[model samples]
Each structure stands twice: as structure tokens, then as C-alpha cells.
Target: MELSCKVNYALLALLELARHRERGKLVQIEQIAADYQIPDRYLAQLLMTLRRCGIVRSQRGAKGGYLLAREPGQITLLEVFTCLEGTWSHKQESQAASLTQAHFAIEEIWQEATMAATAVLQRYTLEDLRQKRDEGQQFNPMYYI
Candidate 1:
């Protein structure tokens, strides 16, 4: 399955927030956008959506910005996915009544696949991602001139 650019950007934006969550400082949209090369307008829109869903909170002032509403460990990737992408079911509800046995079998397999993917997503929280990213950074090989 392909990850949409919108969802990818949302996750990256969240990761940025997660990284700074411990400092209790709000991260501005421009900083996140510039760091990840995401468009400012698009990231703003995504952040608003996240805020509405209680995944992140926004402040309005001279030093205003955004911060996670909950800790990174409390937010699952599946939660973010559902917030941005909606429910993950791929079944065609309208076609359910017309399916033949062969179609039913194929659909059953599809459902299993979807469930597996959902489980994987649910198992990972933003904290898990942050740790993985930190580990990768630590293991990267350096080439000195």
C-alpha cells in the first residue's frame, strides 16, 4: 500500500513535535515545514486538522505555535492515520450484496490483509518512531575528508 503525501507529511510534522515534547516548548509551523521541506501552507492545514482531533494543541500569540496534546507514547500511528486518512477499511459496502463466492474469498483475504496492517500501525507510537530515528542517527557511518 502506498502512503499518501499528506499522511506522510502529517507524520513527519508530528515527529518534529514529538522530538521537542520533553522541552515543553511549542514548535512553530515554519520550523517544522523548513526542517522537513514541507510546504508551509500545507503543513499549517495539517496541523489545524491535528489540533481539531486533539492530537496537537495550538496557541495564539506573539510566541504562539503548536505542541502535542498528549505525550508521544500515548499517540499511536494508527490514531494519526485515522485522524488524517479516516478509517482504513477498503471494502466496497455497496458491492457486498453482489459478490460471488470467488469474490467473497478475495475479499476475505483483503480483510485479513487490512487487519494485519492495522495491527502493525496500532503497535507503533510516535515514541517508538523517535527511538528508531535516534538509533539510525547513532548508527550512521561518517566519512571524513
Candidate 2:
């Protein structure tokens, strides 16, 4: 149930890209790292993996940076999760006769939890997350004012 640092950082970086998608501007890694307080080098590696997965496109040179390969609405949380975390596996090594009824019950719980989590993640896109982010920030004081 725990998310790895790679997954978390990738999501944060993606969210920044999603937010700036409308501007159609390439966002630099330094900006993303600074905004999210993630290590610059670590973020670069994560973005490279995401770029390979076709979730993002990278450009080089002065006006170069990174951009989303597709619209945020088309990018689901599940896609991000799988891209960074890989596929989930429930298999564990065990002997056939080593199972108890309590063990069976616990495994059933795990199965249900995994299914529910997957379904929830698959239902939300980056656009949905953006909306939620904006909504959550509505009550914050405007420092620029």
C-alpha cells in the first residue's frame, strides 16, 4: 500500500506538467524539483523513466525541457502508478498444506484491498487531480495580494 519515492516524485512532476499543459510550454526539471522539494538529480532520473514509458516528451537546448505526451485528461493515475511502480503481483511462496483459515481470510482482505485501490486509481486522471488540487487550494490565503 506504500508508494515508493519514485512514484511520488513522478506524480508530482507530472502534476506540474499537467498544470502548465495549457500554456504549451516546456517546463524545466529544476523548476519541477524546486516546486516539489525533490532532489534535482533524482527527479531527472524519474522523468527519464517516464519519458521512456511515453508519458512525457523531452526536448533539449535553451527553450527545451519536458512536456506531457498526451492531455492530462487522458492520463490516469493507474498509468502513472504502473509506469513508475510496475505491475502488482499477489503471488507469494507457500506450501499447499501450510495454509490456515486465518491465513485465507487475511489473503482475501489483501485481494479486496488491492482490487479496490486499483479501481480507484484507474478512475482518476491527471485532469481530475488538477481539479482536486485547485479545489483544495481555494481556501488558502493569496500571498501575492
Model 2 per-residue lDDT tens digits across residues 106-133: 8898899999989999999999988998
Task: State the lDDT of candidate 1 residue by residue for 2-61, as single tens digits.
Answer: 788999999999989998889999999999999999999999999999999999999999
Q: Worst 10-residue stretch by lDDT in candidate 2?
A: 87-96
Candidate 2 regions with alpha-carbon error over 4 angstroms: 141-145
Model 1 regions more than 4 Å off: 93-98, 143-145
Model 2, position 143, has a per-residue lDDT of: 83
- Residue 72, model 2: lDDT of 98
TM-score of each: 0.92, 0.90
The best candidate by lDDT is 1
